[model samples]
Target: MRYRFESELRRWEARLRDDWYFVDLPPEASAEIHEWADALPRAGFGAVKVVARVGGTSWSTSIFPSASGVYSLVVGARVRRAEGVEPGEVITAEVELV
Candidate 1:
């Protein structure tokens, strides 16, 4: 199944050591992912594998649960370059569970 949503690319600092880029899934999409996760064998960190498309770039990654009952998709360096997206820029994303 596929889900689509729009969100801003956010930059977060992890442990005050390095910066990380991510997009938080919208509430509706997060709920759907949670439901799907309940039926699948999860990997480390209870991550759900997914293929995500942003702008003109598509890549495989996993969504991780957040304290706020949402999921966040990590945006890698390659994807950022390919998509030409930067932090705080809103972009449409299409994610397919894998």
Candidate 2:
């Protein structure tokens, strides 16, 4: 399934002294992922493999389940730069389970 949503960019400080950014998948999409994942095998940490695109850039990655009952898609430096998105900015992302 393909899930599309817009979300604000957010950042978290990692123990490695680095900043990591991600966007939480909206509840609707998150719920679907949960249902689908429940019936299939997932990667470590309950991550679902997906093909995600933002702006004109796309990559293969995994969205992980968050404590808040949603999934979070990590945005890497390369994708952020290519998409010209920053923290607090709203970005439209499309993710397809693969």
RMSD of candidates 1 onward, in order: 1.3, 1.4
Clashing pairs in 2: none
List residue ranges in candidate 1 displaced over 4 A. none
lDDT of 2: 0.91
In TM-score terms, candidate 1 sits at: 0.90
Itemize residue pairs with steric clashes in candidate 1.
Answer: none
State the lDDT of candidate 2 residue by residue for 28-97, as single tens digits: 8999889889766578999999999999999999999998899999999999999889999999999999
lDDT (tens digit, per residue) of candidate 1 on 5-57: 88899887664566688888888888877887988656688898889898889
- Who wins the lDDT comparison? 2
TM-score, candidate number 2: 0.92
